[model samples]
Target: MHQGGKFIVVEGGDGSGKSTQARRLADRLRDAGHETVLTREPGGTASGAALRQVLLEGSLDARAEALLMAADRAQHVTEVIGPALARGAWVVSDRFVPSSLVDQGVGRALGVDAVEALSDFATAGISPDLVLVLDISDDVSKVRRASEDPDRFERESEEFHARVREAYRSLAAQRGWVVVDGNLEVDVVADKIWSVACERLEP
Candidate 1:
């Protein structure tokens, strides 16, 4: 509705319904008459799609993972997010820099500040207008992914997921991102997300 559109991101642990909640919010925003663009990290664009598999499935050290994540974000912003926001279309992303911050930064023991600097360079200071961090426990994350073959990150031990969860909570609080209970029912979580969006961004 404004000159430059808003950028909103949904983040959480595995099986935290990030994709579902992101789509619902994007749809809701579109229904409200805002031009919305829904996308995700690791595969939001042509090049990113190619990187997605390797990033999600490949065995890489923390530094390598962080670099790849940043590269994906760079392309994602340059190709998809930048143009949409510049043209006044809202962008709703499932995951963004925060994923790298928690996953490789904390979970992989690379440090948040280090990954953040990398992310900032990748995004070129194009930060989200609003960030919705969905909080869920490691057990919930494991249960949700039990039926499917695990990805590189998912295959990590329970301790890794626990650390990732804690990092997300801590960093989100430090950054002023809205924290939502992802363990709630989908509809309930969606409603909460909508309310927070309305309350904070009035979108």
Candidate 2:
């Protein structure tokens, strides 16, 4: 089952329904008989999960939080993503570098170049062949999940989310990512994502 291929990443801001879409995509891939691995960043592997709590709730300094994210990403890529890809499994991550680009790069006011550099190193040179960036307005996102506890990052004001959205838009434009509208229903969004992914999966 070791057919080589590039990794795929799905990234978006809070309440964009990334988790729902990712699960749907993974399920579709499985039904289509493709080996697929569904996972999330900041909490994929054991090490990353532990770090996720600290990064989301703890009062670490901005620099420290950024560094911890990078560390967690490194471990995730090495332990989960790399091996899965090596085994011909299609890795669909709910988040990846875009979280850092938004949460740390723009939200925390860290420069884009610095975040990109750290992300490049942490991923050990594995760049996602296709990055699906879901775009949604801050207002829409805020209302999507009213019951979920607001984490430290999620507790930020609308101004912060606006900046993060801008950052994601900029990255999508710069990287030619597959930009999908997150305002749609989960199945519709997954359908669009699947189309893009299937196109890329072709020889």
TM-score of each: 0.97, 0.94
lDDT of 2 by residue, 1-203 (tens): 22474577888888888888888888888898878889998989998999999988999888898899999999999999989888777888989998898889889988878988999999987767778989998779888645588888777788888898888998889888888999987778888898998887651
Off by over 4 Å in 2: 1-3
TM-score of predicted structure 1: 0.97
Best-performing candidate as measured by TM-score: 1
- C-alpha RMSD by candidate, in order: 1.4, 2.0
> Model 2, residue 87: what's the lDDT?
77
lDDT of each: 0.91, 0.85
- Candidate 2 clashes between residue pairs 3 or more apart in a chain or in different chains: none
Candidate 1 structure quality by residue, lDDT tens digits, 1-203: 33599999999988899999999999999999999999999899999998899998887777988898899999999999999999999999999999998998889889888999999999987989889999987778889988778888778889988998898899988999889999899999999999999998888
